[model samples]
Target chain A: MARRGDELMEFSGSISTLEELHALSLMVHEVASDWGISEKVLFEVSLIVEEFCSNSVKYGGIPVGVGIKLADSVITIMITDSGKPFDPTEVAVPDVTLPLEERKAGGLGIHFVNHFADTIVYSRENGRNILKIEKKI
Target chain B: MLINTSQKENLQIVSIEGRLDSLTAPELELWIRDNLASPEFDVVMDFSNLDYISSAGLRVMLNLSKAAARYSRKFSVCQAQDHIREVFEISGFDSFIPLCDSLDDVLAL
Candidate 1:
């Protein structure tokens, strides 16, 4: 867990465990609220968190971990999982024009994060898949 | 979220309200399992008042559609608000999940 500055909460992510996702999302909401983010921003953040965490569980391999960091006028989330080294950033965006039956669930989650986050980064290091997203308050 | 179901003729309508995120998606999953596992009937969902939907919701709906397809059952969505409709559109659910103008439309189909 990256508990350096303004730590909120830390939890372990095991296979089929969603408790950490819920707790981290709540913490993100609280930190965003504290930073005076708009209601619209909060809504968007909520959606983004749901998308990201869902992907981590549905796609990521093992042992997912989420960390929240609050700083001057910004809130950030770092999600690391030992999943099958998937870089969501690399996945092609899905064609929404396609009918639901034809369209696949490719970039829905990453697209939401990209649209909502002020900055997003994905990296694979030391056998860990790291996803960092930040939103300006 | 809790699902309450009622049937009229061959239409099995399930009305879902409240939040439908990851935490609650499982409950909906159970509801579908207990009620919709059989392939004998079509299914209609009334999400006119659902506040939130996440990827989990999408997964559940997708699985349901797959089950319906395997059993040759029809699936429809009725009375979704504009915002909810937007989600359906954004997630490309409008293609596979039939959207009826009203319950009558669903029942008629």
Candidate 2:
């Protein structure tokens, strides 16, 4: 198990793999629990991992890398993929105010990631779009 | 999660047990849309036996809540274990939807 505040742990895999996604999410859960994170905070971390990994699975072109760090009572996870640059923070929030028939069919993933994350930063660097999410313990 | 619903008067009480994760969330969405999204009925999910929920499940619930608002019907949850309830709290769902201690409380609303 990785300790909190470890500089970084990196995982590289194909975005199309379900097994890889599951492995990554489980790793997140384990690290979060080890950090003495509250269940509420744990769920938030898990949700962010699920949403971002799903996006990578659905959209990443060829390769994906997940970088993790824990420090200052906060966990920072970044997912970088070799796909079109996607800034999740710029995606519009779903209009929960809209009627069901009027609402759009997708965008729930981005919405969940945004709602659960305390801070999110997105950028395209070195031909990779990196989405970094932070959740406080 | 596997869901079973029983109706009383104008309310449809859906009971969920087991896990509600990504692959199954769509099934739940379809069930709610098919059965309770109609304008004529209100909705409350009885989560007393529900053991798990993922982000996908939360999305379905949020969509249902929005649909209920459109029809002037109420959407709420009845009963949730601490972990499941914690999921709701982190997502801010507890603020958006009414939560009761039991099915009777939901029915009395």
Please count the clashing residue pairs in each candidate, in the order shown.
1, 0
Once superposed on the true structure, which residue ranges of model 1 sit more than 4 Å away at CA?
A1-16, A23-40, A57-76, A81-85, A100-107, A115-119, A124-128, A134-137, B70-72, B81-83, B100-105
TM-scores vs. true structure, each candidate:
0.69, 0.71
The best candidate by DockQ is 1
lDDT of 2 at A113: 71
lDDT of 2 at A13: 40
Task: Report how far residue A56 has shifted in candidate 1, in Å.
Answer: 3.3
Q: Tell me the whole-model lDDT of each prediction, alpha carbons only.
A: 0.72, 0.72
Segments of candidate 2 deviating more than 4 angstroms:
A1-27, A95-112, B6-11, B18-21, B31-42, B49-55, B62-74, B81-97
- Candidate 2 per-residue lDDT over residues B1-109, each given as its tens digit: 5789888888888899865666567789888777776647788888887756776788788788888888889899988877777666655577667788976777787
